[model samples]
Each structure stands twice: as C-alpha cells, then as structure tokens.
Target: MKKKKAALLIALVMSTCTAIAQQKTPKAVMDQFMDKRFGMFIHFGPVTQRGTEIGWSRNDQVAQADYDSLYHEFNPRLFNADVWVKTAKDAGMKYLVITAKHHDGFCLWPTAYSDYNVANSPFKRDIVGELAEACKKQDVTFCIYFTVLDWHDPDYPIHNPHDTTQSKGLGGNMTAFKTRMKNELREVITKYKPFMLWFDGYWEKPWTTADGKEIYQFIKSVDANVIVNNRLGKVNDKLDGDAVGDFLTPEQTIGKLNMNEPWESCITICNQWAWKPNDPMKSLKQCLQTLVTSASGNGNLLFNVGPAMDGHIEGRQVKRLQEMGAWLKLYGESIYGTQGGPYVPNETYGATRKGNKVYLHIFQRKDGTLSIPALANVKITKAYFMNGGAVIIKTDKDNYKIELPATLPDENCSVIVLELNKDAVNIPVIPVKA
Candidate 1:
C-alpha cells in the first residue's frame, strides 16, 4: 500500500508540472497576439551607414573589413526612441520588433557577454533598452529580433564573408558558442523583458534541430509568456519549422490561409531590409492591400522599415505609414479583434469576420460588380458599405453578386459589411471564383 501511494504521488506531481508548462502560453495571451493584426519590424544596425543590406552585404556588396569596422564610427546623434515608437503608433502598429543582434554579430545593447556592442561604439546608449522603455510608454508591445548564427564570434563554426578560407564545416567549439548565446539571451530577456523573440539565421548548417529545441525550451524557462517564431529550427521555403514556437513566419511574402496555426508575414516597405538612398517605396494602395490580404488570410502583417543612418526613418516611408494609419482610423473595426472569413482571399477581394458580421474587402472590380461564393448555411440579412453607404447584394444558389457604387470611399480597398443571421466564423470557408 505504501509503495502504491508513493508512485501515485510521483505521477501526480509529474502531471502537475506538465500542466504548468502547457499553461505558459495561456489562451488570453494568444488571443491578444492574434488581435494585434499589424506590427512594425525595424532592421537598423551599423550596415545602415553603408546603405546596403544588413548581413548579406558584408562581403558581396561591401568589403568585409569595411563592413565590420562601420560600427566603430557609428554615432546616430538624432536617434530618439520615443520618436521611433511614436512613428509606429502613428502607422497603426500595435507592436514593434527591432534587431537586437543581427547575423553580423553586432549587438545593439550593452551586453556583458560581448564587447562588439553599442557600448563599445561611439554611441554608447543602450538601443534595445531605450526602445523597450519607449514601447512601454507608448503602450506598444516590444519584441526582439535575434539571429542564431554569428560571423564574428570565434566560437561559432561558420565565418563565411569575414574569412573566405574558413568554411562552415571548419573546426570550432559549438558547446562554448551555445553557452555564450544562452548567456546573452538570458541577459536580453532579463534586461528588456520583450514580449516576443523573432529568431533568424536558423537555416545555417551549424544550427541543428536539437539546438532549436534547446533554445526554445530555454526561452520558455526564462519567460513563459513570451512568443517565438517558427524560424527556431530548419524550415521549408514557406518558413514553416519542425521545432517548437508560438507562430509561423513567412518572410517577404504573405502567408497562405491557415486557421489551424498562428502566423505572421514579414515584408519590407522598401525593396531592401536596410535603408538605401533613392530606394523605391511601396505606394499606399499596395500597403493597405497587403494588410487586408494578410488579415483576411487569418494572419498578421509585420511590416518592416529600415531607419536611415541619421537615426530617422526616411520621410517618404513615414508618410506611407501615416497613410496606413489614416485608413485604419476610418475602418479599424473591420480589422481589430476580427477573424478571417468564410470567403477565401483572391486577386479581387478578401474577407474578415467578427461575431455575426463578415467584412468583404474588395481590391478590384469589373464594371462595379463583384461576385463572391455563397456560404452554404449562412444567410446575409443586411449589407452595407463600412463608410455609411448602402450596397445591393443579390444571392443565388452558388454565389452572391455585390453591386458596388460608381465612386468607392477608398480606391485602395473598400470594405463591405455583411450581417449574418448566424456567426460568420461558423460558416465553411469558400473560395472566390476568377
């Protein structure tokens, strides 16, 4: 009897621990994350001085020696964390993710683990710390972008652009390198308390599946509520990973419609990840359409903006973000706290849903008429434009024909609200016809 009791107690304790671990990312936390459909991704580092790509340009476009030494002369006198956070707020971004450490092994903070950080540079201010504080003041969630591979670290196996002779397969102590990475990660978590950690550079050969799992578990151990992306392990072309993480990340493209798991699309406002002079910027129409499609596909959009060397986002980029904010102001209810719709996104239109209402976002139309496949069990009781205009909807056995007005409220994307008798989300997802 005593032995049975002891075994039972041990089993109960183990079960309790498992439950605790599962509850780390509570439903409320995930709901909040999903609700924040839009965020800002800033890729700012010493590479901004050269107006080239952040990490990839180390040896290809610019000489490795010149690229690495740029930090020594780095001094962004105009950098104001408050201004940066405010810019994001004005652009209707609910969260912010900044590069704490890029693949080039340059640290944005005064990390005790490495001397290759902002502290050693001419600008000694803690960029990460200041941004965290600024995010708090602005009521925005602060997140960190950290790379798994480091070119400058002696312990890491790979030294590609920096040393041409030394390949990734070269001899190095991965154990020591992992230990240093853990220490730096712990420091960043403790000091900044970021809500999310956007990891990159996991595609490198040196980083393995075991490493991804360990790092993910370690991060959870530090802060159970923190969110991590799928890039922690080996991922496919779509950026879907096999290891553990809170969400999937589709870089440079919008993710496909997937209600089974959480995802976020990371795309840049300009052509390059880092700031470049005379870079062509995306128009307001393109920006809003991207946001609409991502949300309609049941995903978030992490739009990126590379700040200039002078510590200011290019004037045109800022203006484009302001335009996005303006559009959100008028029709935010169609986006915020809403789920992707029964109508799948297509070239012409997409949809989002909240409770009994489905928002149809029409990007293009032919002769002011749009056709959408009808939901099997759902009935549209009333239909109207989001901005105070009546819309005519004719429902057939197969589809619904919406007659749009001659003049749209917004040319980029016009939202139409459909009041359903039942909850819109319960309806089966239907595809749009060509």
Candidate 2:
C-alpha cells in the first residue's frame, strides 16, 4: 500500500510539473520581432534587369572586363526610394534589407576604395544614400546585405583553378585584404548606420572565419546594438536551422519546429529572387495564411518582394502587401506580442496566448467544433472571428471541446479567440488519498 501511494504521488507531481513547463516563456523572440514581424528583402542589380542569374555567368564564360562594363551603363533613375520604403510600410513591414553590394562587386554607394560603383554610372548619385534617407523619413529600420566575395574587383579573383582569369592580381596578404574590407565596413556603417549587416559569400573563397571575425568584431565594437547574421561564423548551429546564425533563418518556407530561440522564415512572392517584369504575385489570402502559419508556430515571417532594377517595387507585390497590411492592421492583436501556448494535440488548432486568453488558429476547421483537450481547469468565456465582433463558445467538459458555429468566417485561415479563466484559484487543492 505504501509503494502504490508513492507511485501515485509521483505521477501527480510529474503531471503538475508538465503543466508548469507548458506555460514557461522561451527566449525574447517576440520582443525582438514585434517591431520586425515583417521586412522586405530586396535583390536588385543591373544583372537582375537583364534576366540573368544575379551574379553567375551563363557560360564558362564572359570576360571579367566585359561583364564588369554593365555597371558603366547601369542607370536606374526611376528608382524611387520613397515608393520602395512606402511599399514596406503599407505591407505592415517595419524593416528593410537591401543588397548594397552583390557578388558582382558593384557598390550602390560611392566607396572610396572602388570606382566600380553607382558614381561611375550615367545616373551618378548614391542610391543607398537615398534609401537610407527614405527609411528614416518613414521610420523603417534600414539594413545592408553585403556579399564579401567581390568578383568584379581587380584585387580578388574567382578562385577556380579551371579558370586562369580568376588568379589575376592575386599576390596579397590575407591581413591586408581583411584590413581593406574593414575600410568599406567603416564607410557604410559610419555613413548609413545600418540596423544590421547581412553578410553572405562565406563559400565564395575570399571569406575565411578568421577574416569574418575581424569584420564582425570591428562592426560590433562600433555599434553594439547592430544585429549581425550567423553567416559571419561558419553558420551558427544555434541560429541557423542547425544552431547557426544569431537567429534561425528558414529560407523560402515555414521551418521545422524549434523552441530554443527565435526563427525568421523568408520567402519570395514571385519566382525570381530579384525583381522580374510582370511576375505572378502571391494572392492576398496566401500572404495572410503564410504570416498566420509562421506566427502560430512561434516564429517571425519576413516576406520578400524583389524590387525592379529601376529601384521601385513591383506593382503587384506592392498591392498584395497593402491588402495584407489592411488585414493585419485590423486583426493583428492575436498574432503580435503573443507567446505560443500549451501542448495542444495535433488534431486541434494551433494556439498563441497573451495573459489568460489563448488564440486558436483553425487552418482546417472541423464540421461543428474546435476542441482543446489538454486545457483543463479553465473556463472559456468568449469566442469570435477576428474581423467580426464577439460570439460565444459552447464548451463541453465531458468531451473536452469548444463547439464552433455552423460556418467559419474566413475559409483560408479562420482565427478563434478564447478567453479562459482558471478554476483552481476558486478552490484550494486537496492532497490525494491512497
């Protein structure tokens, strides 16, 4: 009898512990993402307009000098910084990351180190400067995507043995190369003071972990607040999907499950990473569902819309984002500033909670009810679709379910709000008797 009582007591204690853990708060993912729930990832260059891969040559190849000549004629006068920043604002995005320098080595700003920049173009003006000014006007956090591997620069080579052209002007100390690159970093960070430095091209041969460390340390020392991506290291396993980066960056899809730290999933609405003409845009419903799915999974969503070479966002991308803004502006309470809650069974809807109330996002609504079996000792007091006013929840304790009305308001992704009041507070717990 004593052994049986001990086992039962242990079971009860374990059950209570599990309940407490279910309510535990993870990292400060929301605090980092509330203002950054959405952001624009811009991929644009002269190559983007030419219908070519952003930097890769089609054949074994084009002459470096010939390919580099594209920038001389690279003129994007119609590139409206206001339109680009406004599109992000209208789309409910508060941050923007633009490719200040792609692999091709053409600088958007006039760098003192390189003449291969926007200043040399017929449209001789600093586009990045304009973008910084525009983001400041609209209160959007502006960031730079810098690809350290520069193919067009005379100092750096492509690093492929098969191509002899890649080996030119190659005799230089790695320390000198790092020091020179650090100069560009200082120039950009000092001038624009970017919110982030999206460093890429770790595999592009010039970048080494040692080289990256020099750059990373330099930037952080300048402004400790700037958030650097995990690419600076050999992809951090913690922040990368496999613990890499400062945070997890799931490219082009909603990611696999992670509860340790924050995650951001980025996907393009169109086929190309950079702006393409008349590209088919994702529907308003699709965009809403993507954001909902990401938010419910305890992750942030960064929706990508490539800007045209003219520097303005595609019209379709702009319109769809505006529609998303309108919907989120109306029904965003459940998503923004909430934590994912409870070990909900797979069949029921996913949940996000704030204080006593929990939100149920019904991706696949059942015929009559949406149930939550694990939430016990709590009484649900309210129910309603997000866009419409209040409704009621007809709960059955025996079945452990919350019955919905006959029809759902939004078919694509309907959200139900449930206000729950804990019953244990009303009655003291009595120790179990064996």
Which candidate has the top score in TM-score? 1
Query: For candidate 2, lDDT tens digit of each residue in 330-432?
Result: 7677677765544231333556666666777776666675545535566677666777767655546544455666676766566777776752223221222
Per-model CA lDDT versus the true structure: 0.87, 0.68
Which regions of candidate 1 deviate over 4 angstroms?
A: 1-24, 161-168, 236-241, 432-434
- State, as a TM-score between 0 and 1, how close model 2 is to the true structure: 0.79
For residues 1-434, could you state the per-residue lDDT of candidate 1 as single tens digits?
99999999999999987665444466678789989999999999999999999988887788879988999999988899999999999988999999999999999999999999999989999999999999999999999999989988988888665565665347778899989999999999989999899999987667887888788877888888888888877763343335557788888899888787888999999999989999988989899999999999999999999999989988899999999999999888988888886777878888999999999998876677787787777778899989777789988668898898887778899899999899887877775455
* Number of backbone-clashing residue pairs for each candidate, in the order shown: 0, 12
TM per candidate comes to 0.94, 0.79
> Which parts of model 2 are misplaced by more than 4 Å?
1-30, 33-35, 57-66, 157-173, 240-245, 341-350, 376-379, 389-400, 405-407, 422-434
Residue 47 displacement in candidate 1 (angstroms) = 1.1
